[model samples]
Target: MTKSATKIYILDTNILLHEPFAFLNFEEHDVFIPMTVLEELDAIKDRKKDVSRDARIAIRALEDALVDATPEQIAEGVDMSQYTADHGSTGKLAIYPDHLLNQKNLTLPGPENDNRIINAALHLQREKKPREVVLVTKDINMRLKAKGAGMNKVEDYRTDQLISDIKYLSTGYVEIDGSFWDKVTNCESKTEGRDAVHSVERSLFTQPVFINQYIFDSSHSFAGKVVAHDESKVELADIGYERLMGREAWGISPKNIHQAMALDALLDTSIDLVLLTGPAGSGKTLLALAAALEMIVEKGIYEKIIVTRNTPEIAESIGFLPGTEEEKMAPWLGAINDSLDFLHKHDECRDSSMKYIMEKANIQFKSVNFMRGRSIQNSIVILDECQNMTSSQLKTIITRAGEGTKLICCGNLAQIDSNYLSPLTSGLTYIVERFKDFEGSATIHIAGVMRSKLASFAEKNL
Candidate 1:
């Protein structure tokens, strides 16, 4: 048996925006982009929304690289021009369709045909007579059309699922011998610079697994090596604390590596702010409150916990709110109350102490609009529902941090309530991307779904 020649891959317009480097994901092959794709991209160039506009930008970038190239080079698809490096040097980009096209197999659909993309793919397949012609798309309807047309070679672009193997990409896990387990029980260990320890903790928290010897994810890659554990080095401690004479406290306990890392990021004095992002039921708000309680009640680092989120249609102004600032905030405060109820169940005197701590720390709830006039000082501030925030809104919240203050931003990037935001251009993404290189900031993506099985299923499938 012999390997067949590379198949011709045809892409739709959405593919470029959904995954910019989509062309590169496929192996060396001939790739075709119908003229219809370019026309669609052009119509949205002036979109004010971030993601849509960004897509237009990417399409232009690709067009610029391909403009006026020689026929041979066009046949051997050229990469978009390389992006500039930090050093200002142009690093060449590996554009897909690297190989020149064999024009004999080319197909040009009618300009006005709505299904020109699919029609072009079919026409090309008939002419090319290559080993295969694969129609790739995110649209289910398009995929069905290709199949109905008897084109068996079709696939959905899996670029969004960056992880090669979803099964293996699940929360990192580790298994060790009973002997090593004893060691983990004995000491505060770092898993030898491993982040996989976080995944193991999630598994340990919600799932039932033997404590005996097994495989553990020591790092993010398969190449990461396994190591023995030391009990004396594994430190397990409850995180909640009582307020003492205007002090701080921790709300949630850290029982596993994920929570432990989350706590460390939240509590790091050098880190002025932390951002937690994930799908719903990922414990983002709960963890932020837990850390805020610890800082205000246990350590007295801040005076209060000021929590707020961008409420729908209420961001532009709070002047129309029916009550005083505090009264107006009640609606937004409901989310904070939910987290508080969770904490109260776990800690003694958690109710009165929480109230006392809130008053002592000057903790108050406000809509994002009300936050404009105040400078948060020595306070642990949490901004939830951040996906609903715009770039300007995020800048305001980040700038409000005064001396001795810390901010934790939480939201689901996948569940944006704001019409203007998509996964990539939301305030959460802007903040994360902007602060990624800053030492004073950190981002942690919570993986486990702690809310319930039904909710998790809905999130994953519904």
Candidate 2:
């Protein structure tokens, strides 16, 4: 097909599934979706997930709008030439078999499946002689095929922006006005020159401001803000040497160099929160627990270690769980207990029972729902499965931390449970996006998978 004077946008199936509202974004362009795209959308009508279902819904609405119009009118409002099996061939095009347009070709196939769509575009290009035959696809292979077919243009269907560059800024000061400082004779935690630092950091984190302040890849935009900083020398709570040693302890030995570095970060008193993200089974939870135990058992720096997570969808609401408060919470706390048991088993030979260590009852478990209206102080809080939290939810959690508290948020962004959130929309993204420049916050994204080969393979391939 030859390039025409008009811009003809040939839509791909993946583009509709990725963003059903794509038509709304394209303006004044002659958009033509291959009939195969509609067939794919029809097959996904029954899917419950928003993306799959919404594609089908959008297609149906388009069909209804075109139902009352003649073929010419339908083509005017919505491109229908691709829906027809018989597209013409002239200079640079070939025709597809009539049988290819039947019901059998509706299902999703591999790269070969996209051949029919390209064929349809070729037919339209030959017949209409449009200015440009541009194939829009999220599928990389499809774009390559369009290029090979000698289409005028091929563009990726990017729905959301990608974040490529990152920025950093100074810390916030505890600046007090002259009158306010005079009224506050206590002046224990007050500091100077903090507001300027915080103001700069906050400006960098939220994306709306950064979009104008800096040039970025619209496909992937990411930013961060700093929350806290430390000028004074900071002290960390200590765990005994015996508990930190040996190979058979809690999956990874603390004597390892990487573990030692992680321990150092966790023990840094200036940092109040740690964000850890990675593939499944990276021992994030275990590492956090071990560091907290060192602080609780060895140094007794804080009151307790608080464990929390978003409630699982399978579990009934809080009221549905049986037994007393502690009993009802046992199901959720089992994972915590499992980590503790591993730590205790590792120290069995040294006669350091976990029971004795926990006898003072410094470990507490709660859910995000229960965290509201409560200010936590003197505790190390671990928030698991944080990928399911929205930006607002994350903001609420971070603001609840009082003095003498440390919080750790850990989860795999690849396996987010929240339906509306992708890796970019999740709370972990929000925290990492907002706090990247903060002096008191540090993030370590674990790339290695410690899980079995099959689990690792599934995470990578599936």
Best by lDDT: 1
Query: What lDDT does each candidate get?
Result: 0.60, 0.58
Candidate 1 whole-model C-alpha lDDT, 0 to 1: 0.60
- Compare the candidates by TM-score and give the number of the best one: 1
Clashing residue pairs in all predictions, respectively, total 36, 17
Off by over 4 Å in 2: 1-258, 314-316, 347-352, 451-462
- Candidate 1 TM-score versus the reference: 0.52
Error (Å) of candidate 2 at residue 20 is: 21
Model 1's C-alpha root-mean-square deviation from the true structure amounts to 10.3
lDDT of 1 at 23: 57
Angstrom error of the Cα, residue 238, model 1: value is 15
